[model samples]
Target: MGKRVLITGSNRGIGKKLVEQFAQNGFNIVACARKKDDSFDDYLKDIVRMYNIDVTTSYFDMEDEQCIKRELKSVINKVKTVDVLINNAGYGQNALFPMISSNELKKEMQINYISPIIISQIVSRVMIRNGGGSIINIASVSGIRNEQGRLAYGSSKAALIFATKTMSLELAPNNVRVNSVSPGFIDTDMWNNRSEQIYKKVLSETPLGRQGNTKDVADLVYYLASDAASYITGQNIVVDGGRMI
Candidate 1:
């Protein structure tokens, strides 16, 4: 398809995999990151050359609310309009409830919850003007689970999931779909940093008996962005191998 996708956190594991997946499927890409990475940028460049796809890489700090809007405006200026938007840029938190500081909690909410909403507000307007689009939020399993730790990060993602529902309802009339994907124990750099005991517990709980991969999440997003999933909206589709159950 010739449609374009705007994916934040493009330098990270899942984000990078999502870029290539959409590119291979012939979707023009707009890759957004908090900062510039030479190696990652070079990788995106190679993707453009090999896939013969249009790719735009943008750099801006998600912590800055104004910058979030400004950068997305810049993207719209260049791409004209984005058909799909993925808010995948988020920092994980491992602090227990009492251990989490107010500053840390606010930071997590700003980057993970507030920032995605701000970006969605901008892009949803564009989508409405351009006849509609899809918005996929990459949330986490901790958001819905009553797990130890994850006080800051889990609350932030919980806010995102709620927004996904509200947005889907409001934007449905405009044909803009909004949904979230919550992945559990996904094997990425983020997971690499987890304590061995934590990893073992999650693996044991996962019905699939294995950690998830980026493709598992990407495939669901791609479908939601496609016509096949035209009737789906306001759904938080978990991709954690029944871990939530």
Candidate 2:
């Protein structure tokens, strides 16, 4: 049996790519998403057929804390051992400070900050029992730098980055590694949803002169979760193509 990895939000975008990458690399995958429809069902089947790796799908909703706890417990029972956990389920809702509603802010915090922390807490226990594991939180470059209309999203991700550092220190003694990946403008559906003007502005600002792809982030994440990064923990590695510079 191969080492097992549990990835949240694995139905699309970076999460989806991570599933494919890890599966292709010989890791048994526990792919979680908020919902599973016919399209995603077919996608999962295709992944299994193409990769020939064990792939399990589960439902996790970051919006509902109780649901998250219940679903995670069920997942733990089924998987038995989760060698790596990728906390990739989050949403980016941009809003200027004055225009940001309390409800939206709370929702973003719940999905981006609170939920991942909770998931880590539960999964870290499993890792501890198994002697060691890796936990990777998918943060964003918006957390590290200031930008217009990003008050809520940026603040929530900033909290997640800080939480990653703190969790690493606390979990290291137990042999579990905790880290975060902060991705900049990745050309996913989320970025495609933005106006073309926004894309031009971001491209001009990016030192690489282009947006990042899902694989760019997934490759880094796969390394972090592998033994190659055995000595690395408690860090936030950015994949923004030097945009922060």
Query: Which 10 successive residues of model 1 have the least lDDT summed?
Result: 91-100
**Candidate 2 Cα deviation (angstroms), residue 90:** 0.9
Q: Model 1, range 143-213, lDDT digits (tens) per residue?
A: 89877888889999999999999999999999999999998778788887988998998889999898889
Provide the TM-score for each candidate, comma-separated. 0.97, 0.98
Q: Candidate 2: which stretches are off by over 4 Å? A: none
Number of the predicted model whose TM-score against the real structure is largest = 2
Model 2 residue 176 CA deviation in Å: 0.5
* Residue 66 displacement (Å), model 2: 1.0
**TM-score of candidate 2 versus the correct structure, residues matched by position:** 0.98
TM-score for candidate 1, please give it: 0.97
> What is residue 34's positional error in candidate 2, in angstroms?
0.6
lDDT of all the models against the reference?
Answer: 0.90, 0.93
Clashing pairs in 2: none
* Predicted structure 2: lDDT: 0.93
